[model samples]
Structure formats: structure tokens, C-alpha cells
Target: MEPELFIPARALSKFVYCPRLFHLEQAQGYWRDSEETRLGSHVHRVVDRPGSGLPPLQAIRAEGWRTRSVRLSSAELGVVAVCDVVEGVGDRTCPVEYRRGGPAPGGGPWPSERAQVLLQILLLVRHGYRCDHGCIWYDRVRRRVEVPWTWEAEREVLEALSEARAVAERAEPPPPLKHSNRCPGCALLGVCMPDEINELAGRDPEPPRRLLARDPDRFPCYVTEPGSTVGVRNGRIVVARGRERQLSMRLRDVLHLVLAGPVQLSSQAVHALAEQGSPVVWTSTGGWLKAVAVPVAGKHVELRRRQYTTSPAQGVDFARAIVLGKIRNCRTLLRRNGSLAASDRARLDDAIKRASRAEAVSTLLGVEGSAAAAYFQALPGAFRSDNRLPAPLFEQTGRTRRPPLDPVSCLLSYLYALLVKDLTVACYALGLDPYFGLYHRPRYGRPALVLDLAEEFRPLIADSTALTLINNRQADGGMFEVHPTAVALTRGGRRTVITAYERRLATEAVHPVFGYKLTYRRTLEVQARMFAAYLLDEIPRYTPCTTR
Candidate 1:
């Protein structure tokens, strides 16, 4: 087995409880604090420390039992663990694992808790130690529940090790547990979002309100000031405005950070962030990713494999909803901006119908392209600008990406770049492979999953932001620079557009299917992860996000 596939003995309980939870914590390096986790931490603190009453492990049987907090490893077992206590009486030794809660309601130990101790015993046996029994010391109950090392119990331990290794070795995180009761208050709830993804996968997601607790203070930070510098000062991230230290924040409070050009980040700060497993991305002044600082510990090896190896038939089936969602959103945006004439509206509707009925990805791609053509042609009508765009630029016969031909074109391209970054971050958080795409053809460095995710939000997020800025007079001709071969946003123009983009992400909208209010940023992540769940066969189907 590869070194990366090694499973810590303590994680057996988590793996037994839920493989997805185990993957999220051990593979992805995510943890959320809650009352229960805190209480467990407090309990561990007492048992974790070596104290006056506890005896060393080697000095045994005679003067009662000896105990110690010990680290044991077995290369053959591919396991290493720190047992809370190991007690010996003459030749026989027993491992005692600590838990925060009391014994099982009927007096038997929980299967997961027993598996944890069983793993420690297995490791001990492989390490040439005489270990025949174990017990769980529930702090709340203040008593030990005996677990004799029966062959069946030891067999369970071996099976769990293999099962856990398979899940950890997979390309994606394991599927969410079927029941929502397992989700509420679990430390990984926010990142896992089992209910939200289940809902998108056509399962009874139960209710999100029951599964997740929305945190207002958990938004990612954006640093756009060009001359500012970010560094570590006294264990917190500090920002200096030119020569003046102006801001400070704890690393834990920052979920993500986007840096614009000319902003400097010290090596120490970068290392600190990487150590904490936070994503620090550097974007071009134009919002393109010049580089990204990612944590090395987590990557879903199997998810990308399945993403690219998907059969053409399955690819089209999953992507059909994405294309239809985009087309319908285009129609809605046209109406929102007063550009949807009866004929143009009818055309968009027809495109949507074709997109929905399309059986092949090739056919879907064609319908999507046509819908975009008409959508962009009506761009000038959406923006109430006096300076009409150049005829060659505004003709909008197709979407111009590289060296976007006009101001609206430039805005759309830049906004799509932003969406790519967003989808990329969401992908990493959910353990999905970003470079390998499911529906889009495999391409080097293109982030196919990112592109697949951007489809639904193209009109709802990027187009809507553009129309609001242009039509409401927030940005104008002077704000965009028209070069000999290309158009781009001026510094102030970029800031204005990005500010509006962030605002749109922050704005609350009722999720059409779930009928719940959530920020678009949250909605974007949920959509990406739901697609992941669909790919893993945890959900029956993938449902794309659609706006009314």
C-alpha cells in the first residue's frame, strides 16, 4: 500500500460511523467545532495526559495493573495509533479507549467504539505484544465496558481496515450517509452538506435546516488592494496598507483568500496558511489565476478517474440538465433586463426545449451555442448605454473569449474566470478532481469540472452582474479600455465589477427546489458537490441549479 493509504488506528470509529466523515477529516483535513466535539476534546484532555496515578506499561501484574498513554505501530497492519491507556496484568494486556459519552442504551458497546479498540489490539498483536482484551472508558459513565477479543470482533477490525483503505484510496469522498440524523451537529456538516447534496441527487434531503447550521461569520476574505501586503504578526494574519498596519485576523476565520496583482504575501504567511490547510489564490489584475497556493495533503485520486472515464452515454445524461438550466436562465436574464422581445423570447424558449429533449451531448452543445448567440446579440439591448459598441464587437454571432471583442464581452470573460476560481475552490473542498471533467472533453489545465459547473451560473451569476452594472449606470464606456486588438477593464473598472460580483454572491435567493434562502456562494458549492455525489452513484440523478 502507498504511504498515503495508511489509516490511523483512532480513525476506525469514524470510518465505521461514516466513511464520508472519515474521508473528510483524514483525507481532506476538515474539522468543524461543535459542543459535542468540544466536550470530547475536554474528556480526552484529562485522559490524554500522563499523571501521578497512572503506572508505566512495562511494570505490570504484581502491584495491581500498570497503565500508560502509549503510541503503537505495526508496519504489517499498516496502522499506527495512540491508545488512551494500555493496562497489563502479568502477561496479558488490554487496551482502553476513551469516549466522551456513556455506554450504549442497552448496555452493549457501540460497534464503532468497539472497532476503535479492536484496531488498537490488532496493532498491538502484530507488534509482538500479548493483548487479549480491551474496554471502552466512557467518561460520562465513569465505567469500563469490557470487549473480549473474539475472532468475530477481530475479523470486523480487519474488514474495516480494508474498507477504510478502499474509501481513502478512491477518487472522491464516500457518499453521505442515507439518514440526515447522522449529519446534524457533526463537525464535518458544513463541508459535507450531505442533506443539500442528497436533495440535488433527487433523494429526500430531509430539510437543510435540520442538517446544517448556517454560520454568518464563515465567509471567505477577498484582498484586492494592489499595494497592500499580507504577513504573519503575533500568530494572526496582518495586512499593511502601504507602510501602515491596518488589519488583522485569525487564520481560522478565513476560509479562502483571493489576491489581486501587486499585493505581496510573505513566505511565512504562505507557510502558515499551507500548514493550516487554507487555500490562498493569486489572481491576475484581470481576475485570471496566475498561481494558487494549495495544501498538499488532500486530493481525491479516484474521483478524477471516474470523472474522465465516464461513458459518453452517462456523460450526456448528467450534462443535459446543466445545459437546459443555462438556457432557461438565459431566457430569464433576458426578461429581467427588458431585452426579451416576443420573437427573441420564443427563440430562447425553443432553444431550451431542444436542450431538454436533446439525447446526445453533441446535440446539447449545439443548442447551447445557439442560445448563447441570441443571448449575446441582445446584450446591447440589456445595457442602457449611449455609446453603442463597435458593429464587429457587438454583433455577438458567437461568444468571444480570448481578447474579448467588446466591453460586455470583456466583462463576461472576466466574470467566467472568477466563476472558474469559485468552482475550483468548491471542488477542492468536496474532494472532487478539478482538472478532469465529467461532461467536457479532457483538457490539460482546463479544469473540466469547473467548466461543467460554470454552465448553470453563466447567465444567473455572470450575465446578471454584467447587465446590472451596465444598465444601472454603475459602470460605463470610460470604465473599460478598448485596445487595438482586445478590450479590458480598467483598474477601477475591475474593482467595480468585482465588487458587484461579490455582492451578487452575498445576496440571498430562495433555492428553487429546496425552497430555502441561501447565498449564491453557498448554492454554488452545493451544486458542485451534488454533481460529485451523482458521479459516485450515491444519488439517483444530478439536478442543476435553475433560477426563475
Candidate 2:
């Protein structure tokens, strides 16, 4: 028989507030920290600590006693809880729960908060303690509200427990609360994508609310200097080279840790980044993604189950959407930046039509190849004439990889690597397997899903960044080391390109379907979550982000 699933008392509170949020956290093991959650942790700092101040239940008498972080469980109720604070006097006990925000407008405890306290009291009673009521201390208002115990409250708690268990047993979560105000402040707003999913599912004719922040506060911390040592010190990441300090940054401000070339990262640093949900990406000196160490918490078995069980027809349909978006975006780039001949433009338009009509993955592949060849032939026309470099550098025949044959190819390849790395990190954050993909066939040591998603973004992000670098004279032939067979960027060139690439990611653009502005970096995760929602059948179809 399967082991009993012990629901946490806090989870019951979540269910009472929003069943979909509870399902995302408790069932799928997904979580994202927000300002409110951080403040709540601060409010509970003292109460989160365990102390053996209170005597045992049998020894309790007239003297009042209190204990912090008291652990209790009830197998009969299938519940476990860590009461923030437990106080008792003369055989009567109460659980004291702490809240970061103020009480309800009417100065009463919210139903979810009351349910949490009630469950705690029930657990205490089951463990042979006499508990009559509970308290909720709202730190923000500096007020305490009493939640008196009664049969009705007890019944509500029990019914909520039964409902939560039922929801957990299902393969998919319950529908999101329609047009609810709670979603705006929710910590998982981006992960849940309630409004976006509703819009895509055709249940809502209006556009999705711009709930997600325009840009993340934290950014990637890159250590590119060779022979550097990365270590954690006082909740900060310290980078040094043989006792010479290079840079120091607070751990919270770092989105991920990127170690390129021969840098060494201490175990403590790795553990710290993992705990913060920031992946550690390892890359070669030439910017090739070698490996990644992501947090284990990102593993969501349910989503992976859906991914593995996808039908061939579904896979082909998804692949078509990805390729179609890519070809259209590529054509858009040519029109906006490059001086495309009528024939070249017509060829691209034809490729887009063929891609849309192609039923087989093989046919789509051929269409994509044909489109890429025509697109690259005209790409060089977009570059401005530079006195600092030879014309041959910009006038490349076609896109080249595996030791790019020209400076333009070299820069494009490096930018693509950066793009793939970001997409891989986004996939892991959403609990999706980056190696398994719908369009790109899975291959050993290849991030197929990352490539699959990168298709739509290649022209918009990577190619655009590369073009900006060339047109602005930010990159030139002097920054490249040309051997007989291969061309690569020098260290200085890599730094310049990386800085420009990050700038491009931070630049804002209006989302095509949502009609709201967001940075390229934020859009990556949003698109990834939309794909996840599609896999779980939350949305009827997965729409790729396309540039206008």
C-alpha cells in the first residue's frame, strides 16, 4: 500500500484561501519567494526557533507556560504542524500564529488564518492537550485576534481537509479563481499565469492583466576570469584570484552563478546558490554550455509525466507552432533591418507558408533550412560599412557553426549559446525537462527543449543583439582570433559581447498577444510556463511569443 500523505496544517490554510495555489505548492512542489513571503519569514524569525520551555502535558498545572516552534502531529487526522507559539495556563492551551500583515478590515482573522489555528488546536487536542482557542498576531497592525473554537469551525476545517485531499489525488489542479483580486499579490502569479491561461483558453475575451513585473531585480553573476575562486562569505558570493578580491555580491541579488573557463567554485558556494534556487551554469572559455547544476526542488514529476506521455500528433502540432513562429520572426528581422530584395522577401514568405502547412517534422526541417539560407544571404546587407574591418567579414555566405568561419558567425554562435543557457535555466525553473523536446529530436548531451524554445527567440533576441553589436561597431575583426580553420572571440571581445547581450535582454518590447511590455529575460520564463500549462491541459494551445 502507498504511504499516507500527511498534509501540513499550513497547506490547509492555503487551500482555504485558493485551492489552485495550494495545488501548485503542495502537490507540484513549486514555490517562488515574494516581498510578502520574505516579510512573513522575518516576522516569524523568533517563533520559528525551537525551545523546550513548556513542560509536558501531564505535568501542566496552574502555572502558565509557553514554547516556540512546538511540533505536533495527528495520524488520525492525517495532519502535521509546527505551531509558531503554544501557550497554556491551568490545563488550557492555545496556538498563537503570527502574520506579517494586518488583520482583516473588520479586525477579525481571515478564514484561512482561522482554519490554520483551528487545525493546530485540533492537533493539540489529539496529542492529549486541552486546547480551547487560538490567537493570530498581526505584526503589521500590532494587534492580536482571538479565534474561539466551535463545532462549526471544526467542521469547516475537516471539510477543507477532505477537499484538499481530493484535489491532491487528481492529476491536474482545479481551475483558477476567475478574475479574482488575490492573484495580483500572489507569490506564484507568474508561475500560475491565471490571466494568461484564461485568455489562451478562450474563456476570457479581454487581454491578460500585466501582473508580472517588467524585469527581475536579480541578475546573473558571471565569473569569467580564469583561475578565479568563488566562495561564499557572510551570505555574499566572493570572487577572488589568489587572495586578491575581484568582486563581491549579496547572494539574494544573484539570479544564477555562471562560471566560464577554469574558475573554481567552492562547495559552500554551490550549496548556497542551490538553496536560493539559482542554478550554477558551467561553460567553456568560448561560451559553450558544458553543464548545469540546478536545484533539486525544480523537479516536478507530474509535468515530466505529461511530457513523456505526449502523443506523436500532439508533438508534431507543437513543433509546427514553434517553427512557424521562428520563420515569421526571421522574416520580420529581414524587413526591419536588412535591405531584402523582392525575390528574397517572396522566398521567405513562401517558406513561412510552407512551414505552416507542413504536417511532418521532416518537412518542417527542410522548410526551416531553406528559410535560414535565404535569410542569411540577405543578413549581411543589414550591417553598416565599417572602416575598422574588412568588407569580407560582414559579407558571409551563410550561417556557420562549430568554430564559426567568420566574425559575424562567431558572434552569432556565442550569442546563441547565451540564449540557450537562459532558456535552459527557464525550463528548469518551471520543472520541465530541458533535454526532452517536442520539435528537436533528443540527442545525447544536447538540450533539445532549450533548442526547441530558442527557435522562436533566435532572430528576435540573439540575432538582434549580434546585429546591434556589429552595426554600432561594438564588435569588429580586431576582437576575433582567426586561425586557419576556426574563428573565435578574444577575452575582451567576449566581455564586450556579454555586456551588450545583457543590455539587449534588459530592453523592453511589447508582447504580441498580451499587449503589454516586458523584458526579453522575463518573456523567456513566461513562455516556458505557458508551455507547461499547455502540457497539463490548463491551456487549450501553446502560443509562441512572436515579435511584431
Candidate 3:
């Protein structure tokens, strides 16, 4: 039989503290440093410094003592871990652990912390070293609490390790903890969302959903500008413009390959990407979705069943949340970036309230549509009049989707299309049926779920990027070609827009509900997975990504 991979010694502490958090970080690759984590690192620097060797332990010195970080492994326990500190006090070996907090009352360490040191002791005994006692050096109260190895403590640590191994081997995350104070300080809270998941614990566990990875590692690769070509070179996805090599990325790093207009893709490149299960999306010169080259991989058949049957029940609430979020964000953008007429501003404000109070999906949809009309009417006011473009070229009616005759309409249509592409990628990466959704009903080849998910992000990412482009007058009139039936961006125009769009995705903002900083692109993925978790009954309810 193959040997099971070793779990980190610190995982024992985290596993005992919270198994789901441990799984999210270790098993799922979702990590964000927190203040508590930062403080712990700072404290560890004092004790874990290299070449400094062991500091003079007033308690263990003068007795032929040696101390340093020790690594130990045991096949019997099927575990490998590093010991923080080992002390030699005249043939009596002891393991000491450093922590940022104080020891608990009555001279006993916290169960999780105790389990960690016990694991170290067990490993040391297996590694030909005498170990019967250990110590937890709590830095907060500046106290070192002595811990004697007992049968009960040994059993608890062993049982905890077994439980951790079981949890780690599972594909999906375990159930979340019921309301805890520690959730606030948890660095993974934004990704884990325990309260949201546990809220619906009364629902049955949909086992098929277990196939979904809690946090999949799928970053994006963006391409723009004409003459730029993508091809496979030496087992890497290389990008080049004209004859000069622009850059290259490992195929494994990319989840979605976005090829904006005029960007060519080699067949070999497509096959290589397909082998890695990455899709290449094609966009028009105006940034609208033209087509996509997705891999021919089989999906979870039952996932689609859940989407068709279980998803509709949640659609009303999800649609209301999305609509309310869209209106809220639209109002924010207008108040923050644009100068709206008094009446237009009042209409938007009223729309926000109505959308928030909307209980039915139809009511929410009406409120959202009204807000979009009011928002677009006020959008032109946000632009500078001193642009190189002819004043007539910039003039516009309220938002128009097809052909987009006016510059404002043209820019918005393109940007909204790009936003939809991103959300579609997010849904697919999260094992969701992008065509079927809670809010947007499945339409033949329409990707209604993508459209639905895009609603919440339209104002935050797309509209925000468009406003920056127009208000700054970054592109000239020559950048856009006005056709008899449609207006499209020229090569230079597409390049400029893609640059700005990429920048907007890279910009970090504090998540209003979770109180964490992540790029808008990351926020898009986070929100998508939150919805999937809810659909699979992993979380209690879905919360739309709404910014203040």
C-alpha cells in the first residue's frame, strides 16, 4: 500500500481548533494572512531565528542541555512533523512550543496546543530520544506551562490526528462550525464563510457535490492587441507580438485564456491548453463574446440534475440579492463618480430602496432595469467634455445593447460582455452549470448563469472600468469606428480598454461583508463559489458581493 502523505505538526493545532479551516488552507490551497497570523509570525521570528541556535533557557541550561528545531517522522503513526524546540536536561528530553497567546487557567494548555506538543513528544520517542514531558511557552503572559505526558493526552492527540487525516482525504470541506467568535479573526473567513454554510445545515448533504474542490487554483491569462499570437513553445504557453516574444506562462497556472480581438491562437496551443482543461475565450474587436474553445471533458451528470431541480427553489432569493446588489452598486457609482441631475439622482435613490425591499424576482428585475436606465442616463455627465473625439460621436441615448450606436453604449456593451466572460469562467471553475443558474434561467447557448452572476459585478468591475476610460478621455475619436449598423473599437482602442480592464481586475478593494482585501477578479470567483456552496447545501444561503 502507498504511504499517506504527512500532515504538518501545526495542522494538529488547527485541526483541533477547526477542521474546516485546516482543510480550506491545506487541502484546498485557499490562504490569506490575518492580523493574528501576522502576530504569530512576528513572535516566531524571535524564537525560530536561524544560526542563533538555542537561546539560554534559564530552566534547562547548566544540565548538559541542547536545543534547536527538530524534525521527526514515524511510519508507525503515518505522520511526519517538525518539533519547535527540543531540550536536553541531563537525559530528560522535553519539547517546548512557542505560541502568541497565554496559557489557560489552572496550568493546562489549550487542547489544540496540547495536542501539538504531544505529537512532537510521540515523534521524539519514536526517533530514539527520551521524552516524557513537554512545555508550552505562551508569549502573551510570558509564562511557560509544563505539560506531563499522560495516557489520556496521548489518546486525544492520536485520535485527533486520525480525524484530521480522515478530513484531509475528503474532497469537499466538512461542515462549518456553528457561530463562533474566532470566525471573525480567521484569515480564511472570506473564503470559508462558515456562518453562511452552517445556516442551511438542516438540508441533506448532496454527496455528488463532494466532487467540487473547495477552492480550486485557477488563475486567469489575459491577451489583447492585434498581431499578438499565442503558441506552445517548449511545453509552455508563450505570447508574442509581431516577432518579439512578449511573455509566457505555464499552462497549469491558467484557468481561463481570454483572447481579445486580433489575437491569434495556434492549434497546438489550443490542444495543449485543452489537455490542461483550460478554455480559450474569443472576444470581438468591441469585446463581445464571439465564441469559446472548451475542452471535451465530461461533467458531473448529477450536478446538472441539482441545477435544474434544486436550483430553481433558490432563484427568487438569489435573484433578489443580485438585483438589490446591482442597484446598490449602481447608486454608489453614480453618487461617487457621476454628476446626476437632481431628478435622476432621486430616481436612483428610490430604485435602491425598492430593490432592497423587493421580495419577488419580478419586482427585483423591474427595480434593477429602472436603476440601469437612470444610471446610464446620468453616466454621460461623468465624462470630460475636452476629449479628442468629436462631441457628436460621444452623444448617446440611454444604454443600448445591440450595435451600440453611441460611444457610451458601445463602450458599455463591450465591457459588459467582457464581465460576462469572467463570471462564466468563475462558474465553470467552481464546478457550476454556467448555463443553468438560480437567477438567470437557462436559455439555449445563452449562459444565463453567467449573465446572472455578471449582474452583481457589472457596476463594481465593468462600469467602474468604463468610467475610468471615459472620464479620463484616454482614447481618441480614431480609436472607434462608427459603422452604419454598429460602432466598434479599433485596434488601439481595444488594446487601451483591455489594459484598463486588466488593471481594474487587479485593483484590490475591501470586501464589505467579510472585511478583507482582494482584487476584484478574486472577488468574482469568491462570490461564485459561495453560490455553488449554497446550491450544494454546503453553505446555508448565498450572499451577493455588495460593496459600500
Per-candidate TM-score against the hidden true structure = 0.82, 0.97, 0.63
Model 2 scores worst on lDDT over the 10 consecutive residues at: 387-396
In terms of lDDT, the best-performing candidate is 2
Alpha-carbon lDDT, every model: 0.76, 0.87, 0.73
lDDT rank, highest first? 2, 1, 3
Model 1 ranges off by over 4 Å: 1-6, 23-69, 87-96, 100-110, 121-175, 190-193, 196-210, 213-217, 384-407, 430-433, 438-445, 476-487
> Model 2, which residues run further than 4 Å from truth?
1-3, 390-397
Mind giving the per-residue lDDT tens digits that candidate 3 earns over 1-548? 43476787788788888999888756655555457877998877855753334333344454566556666777778777766677776556888898899877776798788888889888877666667889998999897888788788678788898899888877667887766666767777756766545534553332111111233355667787667999988888899998898878877777778887788899998888887668788886666677766665224343445567774447787787788788778777777865667888799789878866776777776887788777777777777777555433544445666777766667777788878888776665445677876666567878888888888788888888888887787856877887776677777777677778878988888766555566787778778767767666676666777777
Across residues 478-539, which tens digit of lDDT does each residue of candidate 1 receive?
Answer: 67888777888888888788889888888787777667777888888778767866776766
Q: Lowest lDDT 10-mer window, candidate 1?
A: 208-217
**Residue 237 in model 2: shift from native, Å?**
1.4
Candidate 3 residue 140 C-alpha distance from true site, Å:
28
Q: Model 2, range 426-508, lDDT digits (tens) per residue?
A: 88877889999998889998899999999999999999998888888877677888877878888888888899989999989
